[model samples]
Target: MSLNPSPLPDSDFTASGRRVLEVETRALQALHDRIGPDFAAACRLLLGCTGRVVCTGMGKSGHIATKIAATLASTGTPAFFLHPGEASHGDLGMVTDADVVLALSNSGESDEILTIVPALKRQGNPLVAMTGRPQSSLARLADVHLDVSVPAEACPLGLAPTSSTTASLALGDALAVALLEARGFTAEDFARSHPAGSLGRRLLLHIRDVMHTGEDVPVVAADVSTAAALLEMSRKRLGMTAVVDGDGKLCGVFTDGDLRRALDDEDTDLHATPISALMGRNPKTIGAEALAVEAAHLMEEHKISALVVVDDQRRVIGALNIHDLLRARVV
Candidate 1:
């Protein structure tokens, strides 16, 4: 075989890519149209399984099976991939009576998968088969068969698993999503499983988790001098200070912007002016339990850099700024 093959024309490359896409698109459409009673039956079997759904296959089918298992596991279903070749070598012990077996094979006669079918049947595990051939042995033994037969292979030689694998993957995603909806899986539920992902940070992180509490919160009495409020802001490094009444209820907020404006006023005395006189009243506030993403939205909407976290009584319990959110990776 030549290590350096002649490159095809750009037009040829583009045409070939489009042809493959068209073939796979048609295959997916057929799979979609075929969804009816059997698809629902497969979903029902998976939903009712008391234990995990064990996905098994070989070669290209095995890669699709692994992806399907991951999708199912992440979307509120407990699932894992079991390689068929490994199953006969004592890995069959992983399957239990309660597990639901999802087997994948385009021809539906993969020897490794068939070898484990009898053991699965003896254990009373429900079998769901995804295959291109309905009359094949694995499909015949399946309690529910999902037909993923494509009209043709996307490969020019019709030897590679192209359209068939695409169809199978789409069918697997359909099954996982149907089960996800049936289980009423929410973003928060998904976030819990993907705690390190961006969605998890946005959904699971709360203001309380990132806010500065106690003495770290910049707060000043409403009657304090503007200089005193500036000191509080400087100490907390939050760019603003919450001005509260004698009862510790939030009266207003004094920020760096407010100070810059105060500096422009010739009559204003920073040392003598009370913070209440310089503060901006009815400032934006958030509850400590609100999602950190909500705080980011609030800040953006109000065009402010920080927020005072308050309770029902409007007492300042915490404070946070844009930098805080950035540090927490919630922004």
Candidate 2:
């Protein structure tokens, strides 16, 4: 046995890549041009759905179906993917009268999918078929048939599911996005579906949710000595302390950097100097109800590591440091 290694010319590689893209682009364009009453009907079915969109397919179509299901689920439509083979076995129980079944098959003649069609019909679930063959059995039985026909496959042999699959996937996306618009799904709704994601943290996690409250907040009275403020900063371990007036309204903030700048003056009296003298007046503060990302942005803009969380009255209610955002994964 022997191996011959021959690297293709860069031009050949680039040309091949370009050809594949052009073919897929044309397939999508065909789908876009064909969108009409059927696509609108599919969107209406999804929008009117009282239950989940159960997507099923076979082979390469199955992979595309899973992604379409995910897109639908995240965009405010409750949806899930079911394997056609599994549905034939016992997973058909997952379908209900209120559910909508989205079947995908480029050939529209998948045996696995066809095996489960009667049950889905008997269950009275609305079926939306995405197939390249509008006259196929699956399309004939469908309540709404979305044509995903393509001129040719990107594969050199024209056998593999290339252009056809791309067209089907694009149609799936069109359905999901159309339903999303009709349903008025917003980014906040998307964030709710993705609670563990970064967008969720930015949208849902408020400063108060992650900031140190009550005794955990480092604070020093306006008249407190610099030495006392340093002690408060140390005990809180936040590298900063809020300087507040008698009413607890935020007057200023004192940080380790402030202390260092004060110390640079050889004649400065660290022990007897009032913290208010060394504190930064009108320090940046964020409301407790503001998003945590706002605090992170403030810190970045001011080149500081912490921010004072205040109430509507500008009274200190909490304090947050860069570490707090890190620990909460809000940053």
Candidate 3:
């Protein structure tokens, strides 16, 4: 056989893709309509579970189960995926009495899942069954059954599990979200579960975590010369320096932009002109406790690249630039 196969006409390919999407979309609509008392019961079982939600399934359903478990876990509900096949062997030990078991099976008769249903019952774990067949064995035995039956499969031959799997995944998402809302889950709660993700960095990272402090902060006395402030900026490599009064409180800020303006005036002497003469008074500042993403927004709003981190007294405690945010991966 040749490795390269003849391709179908572009129109034919697009028609087939559209057909599949239409079938899945219809399936999702049916699933949405079917959400009622049964769905509520399933959510109640999961929410009442004191331990963790253990999702189990076989084959294509298993993949969907894994994703559902992850969604639930990241949204304030503690959950994990367990392979039904493995559970029949020994992984069943992972499911405790306090855990709620969510089993997915299109036909609701997967042998791997069926074999463990009796053990789950004996362990006193609540079982929530999601299946395309309401009268199937697994559904009948479940404490709560969620009907995910679809009108048809997306495959032309109706042999693939496309529509059924899509409906199951959507239903799982609905359950997770319902539980999340019931538990009053917040973005901060979600971020805790995803600390390594971009959302986590945006929500959890504060200015204190990324700003340059103490010696690393570029600072100069308000009475210092423009040339002296330039030296401080170069030494700190922050492209800006905070100008403070004798009491060490922030009075103004002198940046590269200021130097440019000062140089434009031939009458201004870099060495003799005090920074206070050219610095921006009441410059934009942020508290160290503020979110780092807030700093990014403040900089964008002002069309500036750096900000001075200040205290209640407007003392320059730290400084940060766009580069610092980039290095921290918060930008």
Better of 2 and 3 by lDDT: 3
* Candidate of highest lDDT: 1
Between candidates 2 and 3, the TM-score winner = 3
Give the C-alpha lDDT of model 2: 0.91
- TM per candidate: 0.96, 0.91, 0.96
List clash counts for every candidate, in order.
0, 0, 0
TM-score of 2: 0.91
Report the C-alpha lDDT of model 1 over 148-237, residue by residue, as the tens digit. Answer: 999999999999999999999999999999999999999999999999998899999999999999989999999999999999999999
| Tens-digit lDDT track of model 2 for 206-244 | 887998999999999999899999999999999999998
* Backbone clashes in model 3, listed as residue pairs: none
lDDT (10s digit) by residue, model 3, range 1-331: 8788658788998899999999999999998888899998988888898999999999999999999999999998899999999998899999889999999999999999999999999989999999999999999999999999999999999998999999999998999899999999999899998999999999999999999998999999988898999999999999899999999999999998988998899999999989999999979999999999999999999999999999999888999999999998988
